[model samples]
Target: MAAPTPRALRRGEISFKLDERTAHSSLDLFKKDTSVIYRIVGIDPTKVPQNIERFTDWAVVLGDTAVSSGRHYWEVTVKRSHQFRIGVADLDISREGCIGVDNHSWVFAYAHRMWSAMLANKTTPISNIGHPERVGVLLDYDSKKLSLVDVSKLELIHSIPAEFQGPVVPAFALWDGELLTHSGLDVPKKLSGN
Candidate 1:
């Protein structure tokens, strides 16, 4: 194949062509080098320590397979560099556990679990947050991803994939919904409709 131009580069198409059964596109993060790149046609997307990049900036890889079965193609870029740092395979495509990240990486300021971003490199290694308190999950309608981040930092991270992912999200019509999350372990395992 040819070298990759930005999604907004060549033909105003924010997508690349790939075969799901053969080769797959992906995102590679080099925390040590401070760089992020799309491993597909070999394109660098983020500069080291670009302040705005996070785990969300990286593409969602299903297990060890790179290819995904879907229709759309897009990559994520950090707010600072504006480079397409993470080329997501097919976000809206769901494989298992809501497949692609469908919603926001939920956070509660009062219960800051995703605070690994605040660590000084030498002080504490940037590993997944280990919040021991929380409830409710984060859901994405587009990527079909659910992050159990509505309360505590979250733990025992595991992915449960499904052929037909869904309305895995619950509705919170009240402004005080998240506030009550601290009541603990009330997160619904099955999506609302289930």
Candidate 2:
């Protein structure tokens, strides 16, 4: 399917910040908690207090807000990162393992110079068209669909259909770069049927 224009995606944009409590120890969040980067010299695990809500093993973080209904859109600017996963996950998704390897999360990943959509340990390779500096995500809750877009090229990377059990939050995992999120945008005119 053709991807909507970036202007159209702005219609459904939402505002959210990363939830520090949900971030992994190796991730450092800044820019009002809307950006995250993986730190080579992570905070000593022993110095950080234990929190069951924290992502213990993965360099992942979740948005502070959850989407329970309607259509929403957000974008992530990947800066100087070669390996990362961007997607949404259920509130109850496991924090131990990687995001896309479990049933509760779905991701569009860029790693090892390959792009793929992953869920529940299943991967479907996507043809690479260079790399995107920005990724746009569309979550149509009522439609039960999640889509990833190449923001600069205005191309659809992939879309997934699923029966979301409950509210889901913006989820991300980074290995070597930084991510800055953009939200509170209007849904694109094309997507809004205008």
In each prediction, how many residue pairs overlap at the backbone (N, C-alpha, C within less than 3 A)? 15, 15
| Tens-digit lDDT track of model 2 for 115-162 | 888989899998855577888888888888888876776556688876
Model 1 spans > 4 angstroms off: 1-26, 29-58, 65-111, 114-194
What's every prediction's RMSD, in angstroms?
16.7, 7.3
TM-score of 1: 0.18
Candidate 2 regions off by >4 Å? 1-12
Per-residue CA lDDT of model 1 for 1-194, tens digit only, reads: 43222122211112222221111124443432122334443324344222211122333221111222221222211222211101122322333222123431111111123322111111112235443332333233344432333223333232222233321211111111111111112224443332
Q: Rate the local accuracy (lDDT) of all candidates.
A: 0.25, 0.82
Per-prediction TM-score: 0.18, 0.89
Error of 1 at 69 (Å): 18
